[model samples]
Target: MRADADLDLLGVLVTRRGRLMEVATVLRRYGFASIAAQLDSAGGPGHRLVQRVTDRFIDPELASASAGERLRGALTELGTTAIKLGQLLSLRPDIVGPNVASALAELRAGVPADPPGHAEDTVRAELGADVTELFREFDPTPLASGSVAQVHRAVLHDGTPVVVKILHEGVRRRVLDDLQLLSALAVWSEAVSPIAHQLRFAAVAADFDRSMRGAVDLREELANLQRFGAMFAEDPGVRIPVAYPERSSAGVLTMEEMTGHVVDDGESVRAAGWAPDELATRTASIYLTMVFRHGIYHTDPHPGNFLLNPGVITILDFGDVARISSSKREQLEDLIAAVGGGEPRSVTDALLAITDAPPGIREDEVVDDVEAQITDHLTGGVDAIDLAAVTRGVAVVVHRHGLSLPAEIALVLRVVTLLQGLAADIGADIDLRSITRPFALDLARRRLDPKVRLGRAVRTGRAWERLAETLPGELSALLDHIRREGGADLRLRDPDGIADHLVDGLLTAALVLSAGELVSRSVPPKLGSLSVPGLAVAGAAWLRYRSIRARRAGAPSAAARLRLAERVIRSARRPGTS
Candidate 1:
């Protein structure tokens, strides 16, 4: 009953009517009256009364701006949460289209620091102690201010230099309110707008919710710092900020002050004792190692986030990190390898395999698109590489095919694009293919090692063993239930084909496992980086697996995409609303 009521409350835009009026006003001012109309209608009768009063105040000239210009202006004027959304959208050309994404990319986060004494009071409240008790000297002035938080420099009682981050007063409640509006709007759009449905705005709204909540909490940032500290503990070239967990709380973060220059002004960085080219190289190396070697990395790699010292580099901001699984990493390797190899067919195949391409997508069109991209940006030697162009090309190509890269994958591309831009800004020459190809090769060879193959085979075998052990019991339970129901008519869909596929899968698995077993024992017949007999067995298994995939290719399963029930949801329930 409570769950049903929660759903009931969530479905009504009138619950958040005041905020909706605010949002609708901004939407209309920026030539997005159509979107405002949707929100107004979603709010039932009350909004129309409010809408007329608000509409008289809006000027018509704002609608004369270009779509991208209007959107950028609207999001900027909407303040913190909206600007953050625009930044997020900047990474997704597939959703907002290239023009808007480009404009959104220019959106900057700059807010006036909160009133003085906020950091002290927040620290006192969160830490359960006065600021003087924790730190000998706390600067009232902020080092910098962002949409969500502002940084204040301080000195610990023990005289350790540090920076204190304080969440803006009422920022959490404000972000939640904004996200609620966005999520409700997304839900409404999915139901009424075909374009929004295809773009999965509801899912995007959910992402914004997660991101905003995470950003609002300082603990998540503290934990990320610790993780990165451990990750780069041994590296002399890079430094992760040391966070003070004992003094930190969800609303306040205190970490070791990293004293260096943000790489924006090339002269200052050179003055700090590192040349621009060297700094860029080190930054690129650090990011590449984090992505290729660790499979997890910081998402924001702009010049602002990197701090340069004489011989050391400090990375700032930990709230937004993206992790790719090992399988995803391998898929990325395949895609990168295809790009580096200049094989359009291979690139198309890898992209299609990794991305969520819709059913009935024309493969040849995808290939042609990819081929054009490679020919334009990658055909020239390493010096001619334009990762930014290549990145946009991939986004355009995928969007054209009605496909979307997984959010994490799109972020990875965003990172690559940023790094390339970083390199260019600092006048550094970077050949991405050269930097990444060696790592991909090493990873591939490592995967083929006997120890790796044997470990995987063992895990697979154990999984099968568990399934085999439980199958009979599960079957008995099902049969018993059917018997209690007075027997059942079991219908099968092409049972012979199913059985054939199952048998082929098992046989191929066995052959691969056998090959791993032989290789583990140091089989005499050897090929370069592999055992000859094991290689042959694995080869046969690979062929069989390929054949099975080919046979099943035409009859692809079409997973349900439409979410009518989900879209039917109304506006979010506000804080004081029933």
Candidate 2:
């Protein structure tokens, strides 16, 4: 399906030849000539061809670099949008593989602060007041700055301390322009490149666009802050900074200031009377509750985003978060249970349920892979098991089997990986299985509850009812199109006696349907002292038996027919053949 926003963005890119050439030059410089060639071949204005011809220079230093390193370097050079894209790709091991994701994970969005005056100007423009009017004290110097926004320390009129986050001037336009270029390139790549098509580049670009756009808006961050704050309001050990929405806008955010030693500072934490082991366990518990219980969790929990303020763990940066649907939550729960149960089939089933694997993939192969991963992790007796490694291993297996995970799930896995890093930073030994086991078991038990079963049944019944209501119209439309296009549009290839087999299958289906109708009636005719429907079913059984027997007797099956057809086509296309 084509999204209107994507189409609009594509149009915008097409009209900007200068920008397209710049993109092409950058791609070529990064040793991505093939991608640039594909983009040029896909066509834009004449400048694309011109750029292709003139852009002959390649960086020799990048020649020895791995693809991931080259890509990371290119993105870092491209500024905010590309850096953000790299950061987003870092979360998707299923798409880019663990090695590439690890490389991209090193990308940091740290940029020099915008001019001190620019920050105040943004706040004044967004809040519709001078900096003096909005706060009793507004420090001109910035506390921190990044590609997207910068923060300033300020005090409210009532002596409440807060930090003001202001979006950089002209960032939205530049980022959007880059996103548009990316969207256009992805659309073109998907159309012309097999690898791009397989990866679904356009969809990935669309998702990235949505994510970057949302993150760019300070209002979304404010909302995330408020929601997380409410979720942990009763927990004395956790601290979520309070957001002042009244003073926040799409381009400006004001939140209560949180001051503490950074969580990764073990010496400071110890000085504050908090043991590393206990602190790590509490941190894990807080995140686990957010994920498995609340179903909404912060996606980035790096050491820099956490703080140790006496007894409280202060969480910062709600700019990025993820949510899990109820069904997906259940799938995750089942996955944890399956791993703990040490059953290959159950693990495989849970993995398949959570991913979008292509049809006809070998179930036994996936099962074997899952078994191997589970066994490898289990050998260490829970505490030694690295959740991040296991998760990355599963993703590798899934990718090997031509499966893809939904973006939300991929982000969740990324969160798990980050948690492992956080654990390492705090020098804490954790049993991931022990931490997650109760939530999984609780979800399993809930599934077995009578109330839950009844609710599932009702949901299933309603779903079936809706399908029944719509199926006829959909089938009718399909049949009408088939009839209108005639049989040539079927695009079937039959060899030898395969067409006869097709006829036989259709006849068998007709007989089965007729038999069903006849059996449903209150009264039915008799054939040789048996019900007519019974005779019809017996006839279908005989026909099926005959068909199977013929196949066993070397009569060409559909697959064999296809092979024969291919051989004939190849022969016909050979030299001096018609």
Candidate 3:
């Protein structure tokens, strides 16, 4: 039962359970030998006694484990923390490489039960009451044993059916220790490698710490379940588990046990008489709404969390939820708009700006490449393209640009990709983007409202005012004096001569003074046609004043300034620009 005991000893005891040797073999299959050797190498300096203890457990072939095998072994050896990391790596195939990440993703952290008596003792200790006094009926057998907790089915006094999630004994201490080690390693990696710039290893480790903390606490999980339930309360097709708040505790959570055929398999769905295409559409819609509209989404969308009813897609497990801010939501809207508009550069910029990606990437090239990929997806279709493909394509481009996908984008990508997998499972030929295009448009129009435009214009005017107020005016008076003296004679002088210098100073002063006056005399008029044309005329008058002064001095005609004035007039005519 000791965590640090020799694997061989555990193997011997597990042999009685028929898979002890197999489990030991799996654990030993990854870097166990090399790890032992590393320990041995360290032992020579100050820990000969410790080396002997570790040497006893070393297997010959473990040191030479393949990267995939080593990763799998780490999952087996470390338990919950490693399993969570492996699961995270599964969503980031581009960074981790497909083979190793796929192999690690297959690692499950299902554990053996503590003795029934021990489980009973732990549960009673947690609740400060005996099992019989606490519940009408308590199952001696565990319903499930995950890395962090084990579940037991029970009934409350009022006959409410619930599943009790009990935190494993000493799980907190163990998880904390492993997380600290991982955090240290993440920091060290960042200090020594270029990959750190792109991988953002430290941030990933910190997020993992937060995720593990949430996982170990039944209270947080309970709250998450409640939030999700409330979010889907009005939507019949999307079902979330209901928390039994009366019985929930920090270490133990009681919730309504969800039940349905496995949506992961097509056979179960077909048997349930649920149309696959409809189920896929419904699932996609629920997530799209959560991410694009509500800005909250489930981080994990693997098959284990999904169940299919006749017309419903039930979601379970609430340990990992991603919440995006309003700004991030807007950026996502911008990304969708850019893709729809076939502007790759905008999508790339928005991606870098919104997501906390690793730095040192060429923003321009990344944008162009992402644009090309998006264009291909948009154009390659019969009548419409799939959203799944679009999402995957975007993920791929961002990954290739050495940009790390923050948890928010990762979750968004995960949901869309999972939906794609579901579609394939249900025989749906739906294009994800096609179904979500209208949703994307609605988001855009809401964000790009007339009010938003007016706010932006007001902000720009304030900035222009600051620039104008910073200019000097004494020089303009001197230039005016010169103009009165001899307008044509001033232009005849060489440009580098004293007259030219004075003219340059005069023009600068005049422009600054004019801009300052325009900003200072701002009127509180309603944003209407009259106000816009008035601004245009003021702009024209300023330009005309400069032109007339220049012409009188026999200076070059103010052609460039005139052209700029015309452009401003055109812009002012636009409803939003004004």
lDDT of 2 at 21: 74
Candidate 2's displacement at residue 354, Å, is 2.6
Candidate 2 on 1-578: residue-level lDDT in tens?
A: 33654565568776776767776677678766533333223335554665565445658777677767877888888788889999998987667766778889999988788875897778778888988998999998889988898899999999999999988888988888778788877887677555456567788899899888987898899989989989988989889999998889999999999988876556766866788777766777788899888999998888888878678899999988878888887777777777766678988898889877766889999888887865467666667777777887777787677677778678887887888777777677665666667766777688899998999999997785565344434433443453465423232544355554654554444444343333333334664477655765776677668667865785634433233323332332233321
Q: Each model's TM-score, in the order given?
A: 0.74, 0.77, 0.69
Per-model root-mean-square deviation over C-alphas: 13.0, 9.6, 11.9
Among these predictions, the greatest TM-score belongs to: 2
lDDT of each: 0.73, 0.73, 0.65
RMSD to native, candidate 3: 11.9
Q: Candidate 2 clashing pairs?
A: none
- 268-383, model 3: which lDDT tens digit per residue? 66776776666666667777788877888887666778887777778988877878876667766666667676667767776777665655668777777786766677776434
Show where candidate 1 strays beyond 4 Å.
1-12, 33-61, 191-194, 454-578
lDDT by residue for model 1 over 76-163, one digit each (tens)? Answer: 8888899989988888877766666787888888888988788888988999999889999999999999989999999998889999
Error of 2 at 315 (Å): 0.6
